[model samples]
Target: MRMEQLASRLTLKRAGNLVCSVCWRRYKRSSIVHQWSRYWITTRAQSPSSRPSSSLKGPAALGTQPTTPPITKKQFPSQLELRAVQRLDVLLEDCQEFLQKEVVPTEDTILDALKTCRKLSEYFRSVKDQPALSTIKPGGEAGNLLFLDADPADTQTASSRTLTPIAVGRMASSIAEEAMDKIAETIKRIAVDKNVYITSKVLQEVVDILCLLNRPESLAYIFILYSSKPVPKPNQRPLKYTKANPDRITAAIPLKVAERALDAAIKVQNLPLCLDIIEHTVSTKAYKRAKTLRGAFLPAVAVAMTPGAAYIVASRLAEMQEAMSTSMMTVIGTAGIITYIGTTSTLGFIAVATANDQMQRVTWQAGIHLRERLVREDERAFTDKVACAWGFADPRRRGEEEGPDWEALKELCGIRGMVLDNVELMEGME
Candidate 1:
């Protein structure tokens, strides 16, 4: 009985070892085949020298019977490998369809489609002859993918003949006006709900589109909408006013956008739009607001020096003064009436006494500043012309009386006897 049990145990152990040895050999063979397959694919893909010959010949052409047949696309070694290739192909087709059919192909949708293509390409990278993986290119057929293509001739004609700068501006304004309703609704929602916030990127994109369209007026409107603080209600407690933090708001216009709008407004001579931008920038406490305002305002006021413009400037300045007065009254109202009278009377006296004097000084200073800059620019231009003429003129005429006389040139230019700084002339005008 003991001898029979030993023989049975030895037989079981031997059987287990044989099974393990066979499994190990199978695993080793699979690993070697995988390595060779990967190396062959890589070499063929990278170098034309290693590629299989296109010509077909009999086995006797090499003077020996064939040992192995060449692999083909339809004859993948394993079912799993074949399935993976098929899956990658299907995924690529799906992505192509999605890109073609997307109604509003935004940046995100395009990126998602590219990501799908990339994954599929990586999976089938070992398939050296696969055209689908190799042919795929980023932004291939972009116009078709985004559905943004129009007839080139029609687009050119429409843009050149029908879409003038003014028409473009009007179209941009209309688009911005349509967006304003949505933006206002968002703002209201954010005001009501503390957790709600606007996406900065979306707002920036809107601003960018408007600027690209050259719609300064619309951009100024956006700036004004965000910069103006809400008026406090009489029945409700006042909300604490913190310094404008862009991160906290549902929608905050950037100072650079305001600057760009201001520049565009100046370029198109849109005075009202320029003024609106200045007002918003000042209200928002944008950095360097005063400097930007002065730069924009001086050029505009200097260019449009008509009586109507003077009246507009005067009216705007008066409005500013009135706003200041109202703010003072509000502060005084917070205290008792007795203190209000003393403070109000004192402030009123000071304001009345100095307002006219300050206005005159400001007007004089602005005129002088503009005149100085103009004179310097004119001098530089004159110097440059003189240098160029001297450098390029005939050397033989260096000492001859060929050039125009300075006095004669001045006379012809209508400044022969003009005195720039005559005290008697200034006093007579006054």
Candidate 2:
């Protein structure tokens, strides 16, 4: 009879928990809850009390403090731990749109987003009783601050923004590495899941982050992320015309100045700015058709030019100028374009020749020194066939410092191009 009662109660409880039926059945003597309680009490009567003592209440639960719920893979979110991921998410979406519908970018603009990432790390570390910081990853500087001010995806004009597709990819990589678990999970899903469509902006941000990582996998991921199309960062600073420079107000800049700025920007390994300076030098001269280049780069030129090399190169340049002029006159017979080439031909040739020679020697010397510098710093065991540019350029190639000489080479390349234009030009002539 006891077993029968227990079985009936169990059946009633199961039925009650499953659903409340509206069937026309007779009501039992006891309710499901009452039966459950009475049975539970009787079943464990000889055991211990499972219910609380009723003393410790509410927040102050009895028996070993109610421990905070542990973070689970499903429960703990990245946003909670990585605030930077939140900021980066907004930035990445915006940048990816820009890259796809508009401009692909470098990591510059997204750096602010990464700054938040550093904050996330700091916050996370702090929670773990540790301090956090932002460390400059070597060669990761190209897209570092590139994305500070990005333009809308459909915005016209390069001046609208500097965010490039390449940069966007890099930022994504950074988020993947540093963002909290929550944000990272989302980003990874975007990067990998096939069904879900990852936007161009998101992929681009991923590229920016991965490029900074300078890992082959990151690079590969970038390609995979953008497997649909090959994209390049559009021209951002197109055709800007600023006053030549201070100290000299003239119709044009001297050749020396043009070479200097271009060289210095290269030598200091400031290629991010170097290409622009080089373009400016060439364009301003081409359009102005002035006897000299823009003067803005004068001070830098004066500082970098070597007098001894200048003289020899200048002499050679003068001979070439005379020969070209003679040939031009012989063909055109002192007419048309040749007539204009003669306006300040004599003086122009002399100055250009000297500047060219000086530029040549400086480049050679710079190369030798730059190689030494990179070698020392990274301890690169560069073979005769190798010429590594940045620290992360060769992900697989390793090197030991070879002293200050190796480091010097890198510095030279940083501020100066490895090959001189004059030398290349001369080779072309020969």
Q: Write the per-residue lDDT of candidate 1 for residues 1-430, one digit (tens) a residue.
A: 9976533322101112211111111221332122112211111232444434431222233344444323322122222233333443454455446434413234454344334433333323322222222222222342123223322321221133323434333332332333333333322322222221223443354444444334445655555444443322223333333334422333334546555656666566554565455545433333334344544586466445544443444444445565456445444433344354456756764554333221210111123343333223222222223222333255333223234443332232232112212233232345
Quality of model 2 by C-alpha lDDT: 0.33
lDDT of each: 0.35, 0.33
- Displacement of residue 427 (Cα, Å) in model 2 is 22
Task: Count clashes in each candidate, considering only residues at least 3 apart in sequence or on different chains.
Answer: 0, 80
Candidate 2's residue-wise lDDT over 14-100, tens digit each? 222421121212245333221111111111122225434321122123233333211111111111222233345565565345434
Off by over 4 Å in 1: 1-142, 148-200, 228-255, 282-430
